[model samples]
Target: MTETAPATATPGTPTDPGTGSIAGPSVAYQNWIDRQSRNRRQVQVGRALILIAFLALWEVAPRAGLVNPMLTSYPSAVWEGFLELLAQGNLGLHIGVTLLEVMISFAVAMILGTVVAICLWLSPMLEKILDPFLVVGNALPKIALVPIFYIWLGPQGSIYAVAIAVALFITILMLYTGFSQTDPNKIKLARTLGAGKRQILTKVVLPGNVHTFMATLKANVGLSLVGVIVGEFQASKAGLGYLIVYGSQIFRMDMVMAAIVILSLMSVAIYLAVQKAETWLIR
Candidate 1:
């Protein structure tokens, strides 16, 4: 009887018929994927444990006399204050006002910064003329401008003004720097193809610096929030910042902590929103 030779497997065909996986690479790849997933789970667990430990320590320290309860209000007191604020129907208003101011400031700064950066990129002479002034503006103490803005724009207007002022200059600087750093070779290639400045900017410069824009947005979000809070500390009638200031003045440590916790959560939400936007833009 003639013996038939075993059929040879083609490229990408499973070498081991029982396992149905590519020979060497399949095992290695699966191992890598498993390791990565395990690592991620471990990291998440570690973070959760750290947070729990911190909360437990915070809850224990004051009650155990390691820290003063009045000065460093515990988690329970802060939670009660938060619940009370929520029940009073003012928390929502404060959150809404602060969110509105922050969004307005963030939008205005981003729009203005983009416009200014584009103009600067278009005109080297204009950029040179404005460079010193830009530097001075960035270096100037923003806190010093708070009272001036209050005088010029009144209380509510000053909040927007301060928030914009805080984010705008830095946004301009970061964006302009990113714009200027576009590869000269790419620009020359575009020029060789008879592409105009506008085309080059839209097609090459902007696309190349998407990550830079994301970074700028991340920073601007925080700066805008800070500006709003600073303005509220001095001028506004209601906001988490006003809450903090009022609570501190009244020695309501629980209220102050509650406001701070809310602010922290707001910051996280804004940052995550920006990150989600970046992901969408990238895709």
Candidate 2:
């Protein structure tokens, strides 16, 4: 007898028997995936084009005498200024110092802020008592309090205090709001199943607020950087903020612009790190 082929398993999708081709949901889903991929690529290409155009204009405008290079330094001058700092070893030292302070303050702010938020969630009375203070702390111009922190913690240590100050209240308010806004029906359901307060929080409230936690962390990361820079402005002698202040004072516009560019890069890097962590946590 002629050999017969073994039967192959067919996928669940409806198939065109004549062509042996998927002709149902699988085809639609594949098309949707392809469409999304094309859209993402287009977005990336558009963003790159816009950025290149902006940088090209910025670099050209100053050198062509269109914009005052002295007041607004060109990209080449900013690059040269970076090289100057690099040759002097100031670039890495100052960056490391600022990074250290930012990391420390960020950790402290997130921890303490989250704990306080949890406490407020657990006790409505405590939340009401502290609500005004939280709002006031968030609203008050943080720079004005730098002096008090400086005096209390001295010049070098003040950066940590200021960093914590800038991030703490905002984190607390955002997280507490997230916690309070957690679906009450879930909490009630958990309790009806004999879950205790702590169980409800762990199982219902905390899990429900992961996105909020990530959002608040993103906000605090920037705030912590701002605080560190401000603290450097008021106290530190060798950080990027100090460099900016010193450069501006002596009219070394290139150095000031370089410092600013470096700060922007640092903030972007930190924010990217947060985004990466968010993606991992979400996964």
TM-scores of the models, in the order given: 0.91, 0.90
lDDT of each: 0.92, 0.90
Point to the candidate with the largest lDDT. 1
Candidate 2 per-residue C-alpha lDDT over 78-122 given as tens digits, one digit per residue, 9 for 90 to 100: 889989999997689999999999999999999999999999999
Residues forming the 10-long window of minimal summed lDDT in candidate 2: 1-10
Give me the overall lDDT of model 2: 0.90
Clashing pairs in 1: none
Candidate with best TM-score: 1
